[model samples]
Target: MEISSGVAAPETRKCPECGSAVPVDERYADWCSACDWNVDPGAADPEPGRIAAARRRLAQEYGDQLAAEMERAADGGGPPARDTATVLASGISLLVHGMTALLVVTGVLLVVLGWETGVQPVIGVLLLGTASVLRPRPVRLPKDAPVLYRADAPRLFELIDEVGAAIGTTGVDAVVVAPDANAAVTGYGLRGRRMLLLGLGLWEILPPQQRVALLGHELGHFAHGDIRRARLTHGALHSLSVWLHVLAPMPAVRLLDRFVNAATFVPRWAVYGLLLLLDRLTLRASQRAEYLADASAARAGSTEAAVGLMDRLLILGSVEAELRRESVAAQMLGGRGGREARDRAEEGLWERLALHAGAVPEHEYERLRRVAARRGHSVDSTHPPTHLRRRVAASGGSHPAQVVYEGPRAAAIAAELAPARTSLARRVIRDLAG
Candidate 1:
């Protein structure tokens, strides 16, 4: 009983909570739209732990406040004022980098003194090694990773450049295609050259306009001054994390080892406290960066496309589930393992995924939206709640598409991505089969 649009036909039913006539669909949950009963069935379950619950509460509170502030700023035709949290986070990052520099200088001095003054060479060498390991290292691409240079993907790069220009950023240097259900942009090497990682699982399902919105959102991280992504702060955070790991106490039965562990306890706790403080200071600013990025998405791809992108994100869980089911089906149908099963899995994968995405009914989308509002769900803890993001995106009236991707240009980009798509899809299917 499905309509031509591929949505299940609705049947009338009485709501148990409010006795209202609800339009019930066989393919989706039936909830009373009038009274909002059973809007979020999973709300009865407790959060994983107290800490997670507290974080959700905080995210909800901050999201509400930020949305209102952004709306007011939009009305006033001015940028939102910078908050103290970003400034404090930057200060802490500088202090951490300073501490790292001090360690490097101390290591050098120790080595020099040991050589010139006839002290223990071994002690100096160990300190020097530790300092070297703790030093901030530039980002590097993984060895033999599948990469698309501008020559290989000119149209795609051009499209990305247009989106970046719309949002006031220089486009990426390269593109990396992978199997994950997400997309991201990051810097690599000492000069911090930008790169885009496009996941086929997510990309294949997006409409052309929404794809532009996706690019705008990722590149927007750079334009929006996201502190977490900045080299100094990002490197400092990494150094502190590594220091904590190295200083952590180990299990020991020997008395000497136990004593050694006890000796390191104070320093370990100090580093732990510093890490916590730095993370807390930066959390709010990082969340705000995401909201601003959404605004960039709107600017590039129009309000409708940006909201469509968010809706796609809301259904990502279902998309991943479908991929898993397809993997199992391919393996079962193929019978024999190895190349045959892998081939079966990759064949027509994207088409099947797009079909599944299309079958998702409007009622299901409404249900997910209600669930997000009720649970304050987000893409991750660092992001504000998805519902809040949607509100902020829509609060600014509709925008015309600043960069369009359609017709021949869209086909050319798809053709360019064909090779990487096959490689990534094969890898994903192989991993899932195992």
Candidate 2:
């Protein structure tokens, strides 16, 4: 098998369990393909807390059911009907917001009626302050956050606008670059102006077309109308989560505190139950939105590119490991323990990552797919299983790219992102060193 430059060819080794020849790449774990030995090495990682474990289990269950349902719908040529769960979820969300509104009105009334009484006015102000604290607020970028404005990256913005137009939504107001290995779309400010968050770790490794596919998938969340992304539902969910956190029972350290903790137990559980119910109600709709987004990705970037994006996603763990390995190797070779090592690590970081991603062979992809299936892995608790999404992308049939991004325009976008690339790489290396 051909290996890209900077990556060594895999050495063959006998699988201890099955006696089968396994291609062992130093970049990845050695696993027996014939008998499926050591396929899921991640299983040995530390167990998650109870809530996270439960959420993962629930996500896996919902993903399986939704994948089957979506497949059937595709085959039958009929979309599933809107169900009561969504309506019920929306209603509950509205009620939560209504409660917040009630608090605001009550606070105002107290202030208006008892303006003359010092104690009453003080209580009224406190109530108003509490209401303000609980109010739903739009997301805001940090002042020092790295942002790419249209003027600075016109070509990139134009490409984004083209994709947005194809997906039936206005383009983003700005692009925020971060060090994460993920991309997302979110709204900011009171007007809810959209923004695209591009993670450099993921972006630096993707081909131009696959990057377009990633954009399509994220922007699709807006075009496809994900209820969870809607301000009303999202705000309510946030408020409820906050309520749950606030109502949690505290450890009793004294006699009076014991009584207080005891009194709060029922209310704490009540809030917990409500949050769980709301999550369950919205689960199916949120998952359906993901599938729809994948369809949009296929349409915008072509099915082939979308499928390739999924393949990239499947091996993100390996990508991350490789990045850390590079950082460590650079640090050791540099011989200096401080800024010099970090600078050495940051240099050629993106180039090395791109090559490492490119060097992943077809067999490795297949192995990751099998491991994903075995582990019931998804991008997160919110996303559907990656394998299922990949299948959907492939089954959507061939599609011509709706908005092409290549040549000089692509180079221009890269040029615009150069500063961000350097900063993000330095940040990653510094973090690893620390």
Candidate 3:
């Protein structure tokens, strides 16, 4: 295997193919005792920083708290779904919290850069504000953007309205389901229209209550004003990335393109790497928002249901994901939407290779994933970490709760939760009417 130029290993060598560590017998100096992975004794060992960064991300996701939550979610079946209003609050909390956290950080950047700190944050809030004002505007299912709901999300919109009424989720305009098992609500229209998308899988597997809870979580984003914040921040970043990429997709920007791809060298995982390090800071900021949403659910009198909703969502997103990898692959490459086969093939290879040996250390990768899986993938920033949510649920506390719920769950637990489950029937007619 070719060694990555930027990274070097420490002390022992590991097999790129199987990840078995090569033992030092000196007798078989060039070979791995377990996997026969070739080695170069002269290789420059990488500094410990890379491994350290990866370890932090893993620890944040899998920490004992996250693990316990996963277990609790399994035992609970799913949250109760009697009230829809509270659920909307929960979802909105996530969006608002995420935006507020980002703006807080951006404010720091502007201040430190000696720019108009007030102006920066004001601009940030305003940008997102535009999206927020139109937050409840639903996405009109377009022929171009086909509704591809995940197995989950059968009553997505109804729940959206049910929970939203309490949270002031207004003007439910349009809805669409993507093949991907993620949900997002957007404000569309020139002045900003309200829209939402629930991953079909989210609707499929999560118990109805959990489904409402999921909606609450998303709509909560709008309620907390996160939808607006996300809009501005994401828009700025997307434009900046695209413009900057024109200058430097790799590193240094040419003189003319300098303003364009300013963040070009900003690697994807690297940003997450930074966030991973600051996970606690992010969590601390978001936890409050979550509390508010949880309370929102409680106020709507669906506390137990909210918790159950969260549990079921955790269970489904994890298991269903593995079974539907092919669909994800299709959506990623735009399916038959007109991407070139050769280009798509190349992209696939790169994505597949990202998880391979020595791209980052195999032991390191496994170590992190092992920890992350304990809590499920959502701890990263999608939902409340299972532990925290379960704690509130069990405690009988209800408020807006927004914790990171971004990844897959434990397979065994998911399988157990998945059995005997029936998907909420899709109100395809409801979507078609629009």
Candidate 4:
């Protein structure tokens, strides 16, 4: 076998913090993740013994966390009302009821009040739709793929099989590394279908255990059939909501907003109250989905490791926020990510947890565009806030962690976030759900 060499070469030394190869620069002094232990830089190289010893200790600690996750996976009931299904379900029911009423009313009006013909208004709306289509805005997608492809796809395939063997899963359908910073799992739940999405950023930065933890959580989503259920439930509601939006006289607007600002108080108050209730209910459904995804991820792996994953997401928020503040225009426009989106298909559990914990750095406000101009979706343009995800990944739920994920150069190159990317997911879901 080739002997380890160079700065990156595995010497008789390694960082106690991460198992990544280190050179003689810190012969004895190394960072350790398992115990937060540090070695002495002045000491001699003991790669022969220290490395194995460190692995042993770290493995034990990590294994314990993994075991707990496995148990939770077997016994935990996916997500509860916290998963947001009930609220979404209610919203759908209510909206459908209203739509049915409107459809009936509109149908009657077509017969009596609209032109004398039975189909006048319906035809009118369809004609308007056709007109809208003809005048639709021009589309512009980046000529380049969303993200640079990384990681060996074949290796991912092999690992999927390995994970299935370890956990008794039939395995996932496809593993895609998003060129974008966000990740997700999507598929219709039928006899044989499943898909997984991972951010290219994730592959560039995550520790092995944290990466596995993420995969475990994803697998849990699969085993529990959460993806299928979430998709079906959401698709049904979304479709119905869209139909309602089209049919209702004012589905998208808050009743009060239509004229309340102009004058008249009582009718406006009532409409505001009704709209508030609906918003709250819809928000609750979103919240529930988030919680469920978190619980599902926890079921798959060590809760602690899952928690460790947050460090990077928090860093992402800070990075974007810093970017946004770089320019006055960005501060005004705030068009960028700053962070959060669980999936291309749906919200993820990570961001939700982070939001619940208030993970975003304070400055992640309107000024995010400066950084967004370049990094944009790499951090800002996505659906959720970034800092919160970092918080959730580092801490569990709203609770915080004493220590969190950080890169090999966290202290030196604050801009780089190789160490904390795994943690962004949970925080994003939490924020989005909220």
Candidate 5:
């Protein structure tokens, strides 16, 4: 083993509240997503007394306010009636899919007619093939991939069921575990089946109730029909984009490409412009979805738990990047210690994260909330600022504390998947090494 002389590395800017590394490039942002810290030295400070008073008021009426909000939502008095944006987006999707289907059908009809009428229809056949390619590809999962099955992880499934019920959702079709520090709910298959993906890196760090809140938040998306609407908007946009890219003329064939591109320009631009407009129109709705999900999560779990989950997500990005760069990559660089090395590194990284995971700073949260309200999603942020979500969650109804397997039981659950987690960490480390 080669041991180098000890040397202190250059100091880097880090989010003081969350302890997450701040990229030199992104340091100018008004607020830190990690802990909502005002990262920019020149950022204006909010009035101290006003913020303190607001926080105190929030703490006092948080539960009752959220309960009333939830009641309003249940009564259909919350959130704009999904009309304007959904209609526009769904309309555009329908037009694209409809046109593509028509072209394919017309091509097929021409080809069939040609056989009887002795008219050449080669172009028609080609059009049919092109239309088929333009359609969205089926969602697929790799065979024999290491997924944490519901049967093997009964405790996890049970927890999901409990939280799902609380969030007004039914069964989850599948669950997948990976090494990252996050979780997401995705739609799978033609029938729109739901799959919950959990990151072991995040799971190991969170307490049991926090995990429930996280799950509740995700399941809320399903209950609120956000998943279905997203499939229509995002999925259609993705498929149409792929089609356009494939059909776009190559610069290499400049002379012929110009004519081809000119012929297709109008339709292509129309689709592109529609998607952009859709994003703009739905910005508020998208943000509203996040707030509503936070409410559901708070209702299912405790206010504290939902807030804790949001805080962790905001901060975990930097923590995750650091773990990949330092502990995981460092161990991988050494001679193969196999699964043992990966396990040790993972445990050590979790400990480090736990140490940094303290109470969220109040001033930081208030500053971020202000920044987010002013900035909106001009930066293409998928989710609303963590501060806003945190505030919304803080003002939610109370629930009995939920503990989903802890102590030895939690350890057993963790141990049962040691091999899988170790395998994933090694794979990630190898990828990073490259």
Candidate 6:
């Protein structure tokens, strides 16, 4: 492998030919053991056809796995059993917690021993104080955004309740509207109360069935209890990071800090490295979770409707990128003020969406497929590649799209949400202009 300048090769690597798991060893730098794919710095690029075929095989592998899992689920198999990744992630989380407990006990003992030996207790107290600093704040949404409660937006709540029923889950605790091209479900507070952030851009474009698919996918995360598991893992990893950040401000105790870090370095790094590995291992589980969510959407509506939602998402992403990178400034930046600027930005985005909707050429989709295939899976990617997801969606036999709501009901939901969406747009414009 040709290592980047000033950076060493990672402890693990993937096989270039098949994208299969490569067993890590001292010889990993030389070649992939799984497929014997060598990294030759001087080798000329291979033909595009060979690379394309390799990527296709990798995507097919993922698609096949998903298909078999879906088949088993359909056969009345209870939810798919926890795989190796989930188990390992749970184990790592427990290990982190255990280490934290060990630190607490050590600090207590040190304080007791220091008092008995006529040594100052300040040192021990300091260590305990550092532990206190490790308490993580819960994740929160932007406070500037407009939030709607069930009481405030009964019609919107009704819509949420309707979608939740379709997906076999309860409605969210709160909903926040934002100016963006995406929507998400997250939580805040000790109880991890679920909050949904709805993007106006997404809401404006989706058909009723596609809207159901979108809502189903978001609520599916909550129904499956993925949020709590994610929080546990996040808390474990973040505690370590908080402690590291605490250590950085102690220049007066540089020697002490160095000594302490040296003593704990290997253990600390082992934990960090293990956490990263766990992330990699659990990535497939995360992707599987996404697929399950997609399946929920399909079950709630039609397979075709769910695929349509995904297709719209693909097109939206392309248009959003184009507007943000190439066209937004020219149209929106020279405005008299933030409101006009915001209006221009929104108009530009909508215009582009209009241009592409049902009009994006086959060549555009082919280009998107090619890019997705080439991109494959990255270490940090939480979801599967778009092309692979589209393939999985297509694999399910077609069914008539379910209509869970009439036009009037859809209009009621949109009408209730209009004010919040407008407020969000204004806030975004102000922020951008400032």
lDDT of each: 0.82, 0.81, 0.44, 0.40, 0.62, 0.63
Query: Per-residue lDDT of 190-234 in model 6, one digit per residue for the tens?
Result: 888889888766755666788777887788777665622487676
| Per-prediction TM-score | 0.89, 0.90, 0.41, 0.40, 0.71, 0.70
lDDT of 2 by residue, 1-434 (tens): 98669966658999899899998777677888898888777653343654456566677877667777776676676785678987888899989888888878877888889877757767777777866777889999756557988998898899888988888877899899987778999999999888899987788788888988898999999998888888888888888877777777667788988898888888888777777787778777888888888878878888888999999998787778877777677667667566676687788899988998999888788889997777766787767778888887777668879988899898888899989899888767756654
Error of 6 at 380 (Å): 6.7
Residue range with the least summed lDDT across 10 consecutive positions in model 4: 376-385
Error of 4 at 267 (Å): 12
Q: What TM-score does structure 4 among the candidates reach? A: 0.40
- Rank the candidate models, highest TM-score first: 2, 1, 5, 6, 3, 4
Model 3, span 218-329: residue lDDT tens:
6776776532234443343333233233333443357745544454445544444333433333333344445445545443435666765544434343334333443355
lDDT of candidate model 1 versus the reference: 0.82
Better of 4 and 6 by TM-score: 6
Q: Pairing residues by index, what is the TM-score of model 1? A: 0.89
Error of 6 at 331 (Å): 8.1
Best by TM-score: 2
Which of the two candidates, 4 or 6, achieves a greater lDDT against the reference?
A: 6
lDDT string for model 5 (206-273, tens) is 77778777788888888776622476666666666666576565574676788878877887776556
Question: Model 4 over residues 60-148: C-alpha lDDT tens digits?
Answer: 33333333333343355332323454555566545644544555555555545667664787765654453343221222222322211
- Model 2 regions lying over 4 Å from their true place: 1-10, 16-18, 44-51, 111-123, 322-341
Tens-digit lDDT track for model 1 on 1-434? Answer: 85488776667889998899888776667787778887776544467753345556667768788788778866775777677876787788888888777766776777776686656466667767876877778877765558888999999999999999999988999898876678998999888888898988899888989999999999999898788788877877787888888987888979988998999999988887777677777767787788889989999999999998988898888888888887777767666676777697797788788888878877678888888888787886667899988988888789889999999999999999888878777766656756
Badly placed stretches (over 4 Å) of model 4 are 1-91, 94-154, 161-170, 188-193, 224-233, 236-304, 318-434
